[model samples]
Target: MTQSMATRATVTVAAELTDRCDRCGAAGKVKIGLAGGGELTFCGHHANRFADGIGTAAERVVVESGFGWKGAQPI
Candidate 1:
């Protein structure tokens, strides 16, 4: 079965951002998927800043494991 256009777009953006982040020596995953399908990556600190942007730019942000802290759980 053929993939939908949105799926294809998301894949393409993910791949592109992943490569860019790697080339840039970024530590964490290249977060993609915000409003209008925008893609971007963030280091340990900036990840939080981009968190909202990621949610707004693409449909969903893809987070790479082994890059950032998950924070403590609430009691």
Candidate 2:
């Protein structure tokens, strides 16, 4: 993955994602665009579980409004 892609992310707030978690079949609270390519949606539990990695690996992240995703930076 390119450093530019990994570092450049469009962060947004959301209520729910378009689909379920990529890692697990649960409601998605955070949606992430990958640095390599593609996207991932994770439940609140998983989002917190992979916070540190997500912060570095995601190209973009959409977090629920008013909901804190450890990997997300406020916009």
Best candidate according to TM-score: 2
lDDT of 1 by residue, 1-75 (tens): 332222221322222334334234565455655566455655545554444344335565554554442221111
lDDT of 2 by residue, 13-62 (tens): 87656679888898888989898888888888999888767878888888
Task: Report lDDT (CA) for all predictions.
Answer: 0.42, 0.77
Question: Candidate 1: which stretches are off by over 4 Å?
Answer: 1-25, 68-75
The per-prediction tally of clashing pairs is 7, 1
Clashing pairs in 2: 14-64
The RMSD of every model to the true structure, in order and in angstroms, is 10.9, 5.6
